[model samples]
Target: MSAGWLRACALVVMGLFSVCALAKDKQPTVIVIGGGLAGLTAAYELQNKGWQVTLLEAKPSLGGRSGMATSEWIGNEKTQPVLNKYISTFKLSTTPAPEFVRTPSYLIDGTYFTAADLTTKQPATAEALKRYETTLDDLARSIEDPQNPSANNTLHALDQISVSNWLDRLQLPATARQLVNQQIRTRYDEPSRLSLLYFAQQTRVYRGVSDRDLRAARLLGGSPVLAQAFVKQLKTIKTSSPVSAISQDKDGVTVKVGSVGYQADYVVLAVPLRALNKIQLTPALDARHQGAIKGTNYGWRDQIMLKFKTPVWDSKARMSGEIYSNTGLGMMWIEPAMKGGANVVVNLSGDNARVMQAFGDKQMADQVLIRLHAFYPQARGAFTGYEIRRYSTDPSMGGAYLAFGPGQISKYWRLWEMPLQRVAFAGEHTDTLYPGTLEGALRSGQRAASQVQDLAAGKSFEPAKVVPVAAAAAAGAVAAKKGNFFTNLFGGDSDKEPVKAAAPIAPAPAPAPVPAPAPVQAPAPVAPAKVEPAKKATVKPVAKKPVAKTPAKKTPVKKAAPVKKPAAKPAATQTQAQ
Candidate 1:
């Protein structure tokens, strides 16, 4: 061969090796230790970062918190930004559910009263209620932002007391106190188990939503559909496999599932706090994390769904279907009846939930009918069938959302956010601003995903910035070129730290990361089409601007016909899961 040809051949071979080495180096491995929305989200985000992700679920199924994936819970940008991002980017189908109740009232004692009757029952009660409201609002205001609940020193006083204690000092009457305790039970835990500041912050979050546009409250197919939609987007996921131990050293981490061990650069521990505390970490976590996990508690919630022979509440003029009571039932409401749909739903929390947890099917059904009879005398005969979903005692899910008692938040607020050596945390517990809500779980997962990415780049961690639907279109082009770790491909905003683009590789799964986002939101039909798509459009503007927008514009007509039909039926089926 000629000297020039020989030289060219050597140069070509050298170039090939360099490219191969770079591809191998750029792809990192992450083991997500849960299959709930938070863990799924972390896996999804890490996959976007060109990382290999393996998700482990203890249960046979993949949906972690299927109870919360109702038609009304998806794609809320202000609260549920992660789901909102999915709704926009993937064009998930969504539909409106009937109002929880038709009447503007609540069931109290054995009589129907206006929602405010408890406070206005008498002059003394009204005055006591006023003082209570004023104190709650004042304390809530002390929380400058949900992100920092203890920003005010005065608020720390709340961390030292329980809601029950706080209420006692308010001088509320016996009836009023029982009513408040029941209301707290509806939330998750009893007043004594909840921190006054924690409860106040939560109240503030709810009050913040007093002005929400209910017209926009829509549901995706359901939580199961959302979970499956996420499953399809991910490359590797395992079910019915529980991790026994996780040991992280200076070099990397090893996660043992059953007898088999999987090694990775980092591990995202995303299980529920109760389950999390059980897992054996080789080098026990820091005192702060141990303390937080030990001190925090989970509330019990049992959803008793009843099917009646007819819409008894509506036909009998029983005042209303919605009831918030101190009775065995904490919060009860009826759905607009249809085939396969339960007529009434009784959500029992705290002590009530615990009581029902030990009851047999017949006992549970009997207890529900007996209590429901007070509001609707015709309820017993009208009852046809019953189904119960026990979230608090689910094997995979230790219980409902985390309930902070006394001062758990002050001592452990930052611990949940802290990352251990080659270990990161994600789940509702880690989210400070939106904890206990689906929004919190999703945001926490995204945050953990970003932490691993930052760890790999040798940079300090930064929280994930949710790209707004309004700004997505404008920011799409800029985000793609910059490769902002948070919103790069799904281009919505430019607030995140930039990372390098996925290195095109021949055999590795990292090359397929770009395609994953295409389907992240295919779970919800219209939320992305209408609400978040505005922001997602920016992310897609880089490449999917045409496909995403074109389909969104047309889905209004198409989604109306096909998607809505399936969506409506799924809404009926899945509402019971919640």
Candidate 2:
């Protein structure tokens, strides 16, 4: 052969070898769509599984919904408080609590209960407490046991229900119901509209053996520590990249996120349902999958984080824990300050979330103080600082997390797990049982990672882990907190079903009001206008508490539960459309 011909052959050989080397590595480039716990967990897990990952976050910082909250502290030195540190060891960034405190709050259920006062020392009944313990033990066993035969098949049967249904069945006392509803409301962002399955899963995941011992728990710290762990393994991560389109052909899938393009053997979409719909899929997703995504949106909760200097009022409730109530501000939980002052995270959930989001921090603080004053006269002039985060108006995530109403299981649950072409979906919403939770997000992330792993290994796709009906039923009644999207998705199927979209009935009429507690004169002359700033404390350097070692990595395997078509009968229905 001529010299030119030989050179051409050599070049071709080099190109072929390069391609072979890349294939041998089996390192598929993965682009995680969202940076929330779900997306972060997936990227972290995949990287750990030896995949090349490039996380694309549309927001300016990492940790989509769960990230660090920064604000000036009220102490000698500026302090930063950890907002979410329970999953810290996993792959998030955070600082140790230098100090923490609580702010005063009130219950607006007509009969007010302030964090400062309430004579009910034994708040829970023996039966309720026992049931709570039993449920927790069951869940602890469920998650802790990777090899439990029923580990995979939890969702196939229509076993899990919503919190409301569970409560109704239990016939819990009004006080007990109020407490349970508050917990459920905080999680679902809607008291009466949540799914029993979702509530059960969360209670299991979050409700450990005791209030203090759940899930390698931590006080609220931001996602910095989590991000640190997750991002440390990746070589590159690009931000401000909003993927607009994706197409997959025979060779690989190509994605367009703004000006740049990414090609991968497979593409994993880890965004919220609403954002996923924005991306163009070349081979369209099945209508059912499309319906699930387009139908469900994240729940909204506006945060009014407040700081206080003193614990002036006292009755029985702890200032730094969640207080349940039936009111506009669904629940109020206090966190001790990382600085010298106390921090209170108020959740304005359901329909009122948007209105709270619109109010200025000062106005919100004033409103909160007024409520506290009405509930506890001793709470006057105790406020120090304030801040607010309205998830409804947030640009990055349309809202908080995903919540489904009744009939959602029949229509959208299975569809969320079904893969489409080279496009795979994963996120909290994809989790039917534990939808809209950190653990759920983690589980979904791990699921996506497993799929990507299978494809890379040249193996046929394995089925998802389905939770069994018997096992779910055996555990306990599930909570019923449904949302509007679910009603729209499955309501048309049954006219007899209870409509969850219709605004829930106003909770039991408020109890007769007791005379107000005697007002104590203020020690200092302070105006309500300067209550407190909502800023979270600054980060402080402390000896890092040792991060928890993750459980031994388990071989990715799917366990099958008895599969059957969903029960046709519906218990709940939606009255509202759109």
Candidate 3:
């Protein structure tokens, strides 16, 4: 051979180490869409597992609805391994007393009743309530698997009717029904608009739960702490990068944001299913996934986070700041505060949430303040500032969370988490257990991370864990107080029948047209609003204790029609996930 030929052969032999090093550096890549709990969890898991991850969020901040809430409470602790793991891993704190001195209260008209009060003074109402809960527990036991609810094909008939229809069948007392509506109306629509199968799934975990216990298990800083933890560990998070399109070909997936494209071996769309309405998918998602994007039922939530000059509801009034009511003002609860004052969350859910949109924020806040003043005339002047979050009007989060209606669960449950080509799904919407919950969101994220890794390794994807139908039934009847989302592991269905779009059942009367948002200014560009809370104090039911002032986060303002203001800067401003 000539000298040149010999030199080329020598170069190839010496370059072997460099070639191997380059291979090692080229890690499998994934683009996680939506920077909420699910998205953050997926990105965190994948990054730690040696995958290169790029996270995209539409909102100026992350955490999705979790960010908007005053705080979060955990549920079904003993049954959920994922939740336990997250707490220990992050060193998140959980306390038994949620700092409230008393249990929550219920309001019907102008009167207030503690849960104990109802059971004692109104025996008939309490009996009716017990009967209704027992019925739900019995019904929930029929489904062996929530994600594959049709596994108990005999129960499919329930999918054909409204939850209202079923409740009507139960012949519940009017007072009992009103109380049930209060429990459900905010997260779900009027029971008339809800699905019986969907309701049954929620009731599956209905048994063996105590509200005080559920409320006490929350992370000390709320569920947002989990999101903050993920943000700390991930590297390529791009907030405000609203992805407009996603496409996957033979080699990999490409996510588009405005004019830029980020390519990856796979993509996990961790956004709310409804949010897909705004995103373009190349070649389009299959009919099943598309049906979910169009048909998944979510509801509106209006929460006015109010800070009071005193924790009067707890200290002087012997109330827990918990109000379950029939009024337009939904539910209220106390969260931990800095020192002396109480921080209360005023919620209007479902139709009430939609209806309240007609009023300006000031009008809404005034109405809320008046509602509280009507009952607690003792604390009329104790009100401070407030922050309002109307989810239906929020551009980033179009609604609260999943509230599957008649036929939706049966039609799309199996396909909820299945990946199409290179795209996988995550979110509270996709999980069967703890659906629409913080724990569910985190668990789904971990599953998506595993699914992505499996796809790359050419290994079969493992699904969420499953409980046998016989086993679930054995747990017997327990009353569930309230729940956001509920399900057990939902995995791939390669050997199962293909999922199809739901055939419409006659829906209950459509709720009042979702109130059009007042002509309002879009969000102003700002860092996530920081809450300066008053220190938390315990209540003594019989004693009046001094309360420290927990200043409000914003000034009380007069009602004014919100005029849309021109953007001061780009609408999509990036920030750290917290």
Candidate 4:
């Protein structure tokens, strides 16, 4: 072909391509980076507001850590169940968490310490518990009026010491110390590293953990349900699409997932803090934001499940609960089997997780069995088959919730908590109210949704002001009443450093009341109408008459001649018409 002809053909193809591209540019899309509770919630919230959303999950399913898989045991029966409660909220059915069997004593060093030995049911003799009650009462009152010398100075003083140090200073008995240590372990993973203020907050949150409340506690369907619900509600979600690079301009963001790339008007970084370190961002994060991401830390916790043909019950020791092992597996809880057979789930955390992972499942169980036998001296051979879960190796969560140590709370908590550009951070970790819990996860999601809603609505948002001292104190009071550790930590003046109310902003001059005019004289009333308007009489329309048309006359027929008829007679009457 001639060069001119080839050039003309190329022009035609180019023109057609331009038209197609223009058509594609008319639609707007938003991309969410992760499929955890936060990401899913953000997408769901945006979709409800009539925005188009595309969620990308690195895993085959949604629900990040919340939806991670676990096996549940009911008696001897075993079944794999998704743990998240979002499923039930989406109206999906789920099996309940196993019942809590009352385990009274720990078989530590071949000696059993039963519940009765720890604290007497009598009110007066329990000096340690009495002191605990007194401290809790005093703290609750102080939180209510934090500016009061009793409460305001207490926080400052306690903030200076470690929980372990404070426990030592209190002159607690060995058993009492052990009990306090268990509660600390349950809250912070390690008592020595946790702050005195943190422990005080925990005691305030749980109202001093007692058996009555522990019996009522239950796990929300776990994380799996949340994952499934998120996927089920999304209009379009891409799974197994991990983003490698992100490029952003004032106009929008370009995200590269595997080989495919997407450009979005707004982009939400819904991935966890740990995972964010791996992603490369164009134009780079501001130094402080980068610092926050680099510094965020989470704790590694492990959970183990053991299934058996028979229950490991010890009649002599009357033990069916958890025991604190000095050998580092931390403590083990006896999980009741829900499936009409014998089974158990043992949850271990902190150093225990790290140590157990190194030794593997059987060794960990053997150690637990050894401790169990030492306490009961019976049922040494009770366990049939055991299963273990190591969160340190889990791909999605990596660890449990983020942890902050003494003096660390006052630093970086604010910066890391802020939203970055069009990107917002959420998860249990971001929830100042209930960090590292399902409740916190839900609240963070709602908070993010609110921010995005404000942005979409063209509403202005300033950084959330520091919580007030009085308000914080009030919140602390509630946390103490409820016995919530995280809420107590973040709910009060810990972050805000509250000052007394600034004289209540003095009600703006009561808007100068205008003088009232003289009362006007009343006008005389007119009489009511005497006659009612006649009702429109019912009148059916008359039927219309039918119209008739005139008929037209027919033309006359021509007759054959009579003589022809005579001649036709011979022809068999062929001309009979007349």
Alpha-carbon TM-score of each model against the true structure: 0.72, 0.63, 0.77, 0.64
Give Cα distance to truth, residue 399, candidate 3, Å. Answer: 1.1
- Best by the TM-score measure: 3
- Write the residue-wise lDDT of candidate 2 on 317-420 in tens digits: 44444465555556766665558766666777654564454456677677876776665565666677676665555544556777655435445554556455
Count of clashes, each model = 15, 69, 17, 29
lDDT of 3 at 504: 29
Per-residue CA lDDT of model 1 for 446-521, tens digit only, reads 8788777656655544433322223222222322344332232122245455432221111111111101101111
| lDDT: the better of candidates 2 and 4 | 2
List lDDT for all candidates, in order. 0.59, 0.49, 0.62, 0.48
lDDT of 3 by residue, 129-221 (tens): 777776676567655555555443334545666777667666777877777776776555567667777777666643355555445454566
Question: 222, model 4: CA deviation in Å?
Answer: 3.9
Candidate 3, residue 174: lDDT: 80
For TM-score, candidate 2 versus 3, the one ahead is: 3
lDDT of 2 at 137: 37
Question: Candidate 4 residues 1-578, lDDT tens each?
Answer: 99999999999999998986664443434677777777777677666655566777676656665522243111111110111234445764444433333333453444445545545442232466446445544444334422121133335334444555545545666655565565446445555555455445444443434443233223334455455566666776776677666665555556776655666655667766667776777657777567656554455555555655556564554435555544443555554455544544555665455445556457777875665556545446655766655544454554566554454443344444455444556676665534555445554565665554444334444554433333334334433444332323322223334333222112112112212212221111111111212131011111231111222122122111111111100011000000
Model 1, runs deviating above 4 Å: 1-26, 68-70, 73-76, 97-104, 114-131, 315-322, 340-342, 460-578
Better of 3 and 4 by TM-score: 3
Quote the positional error of residue 493 for candidate 3 in Å: 38
RMSD values for the candidates in order, in angstroms, are 17.4, 14.8, 15.6, 31.3
| Candidate closer to the true structure by TM-score (higher is better), 1 or 3 | 3
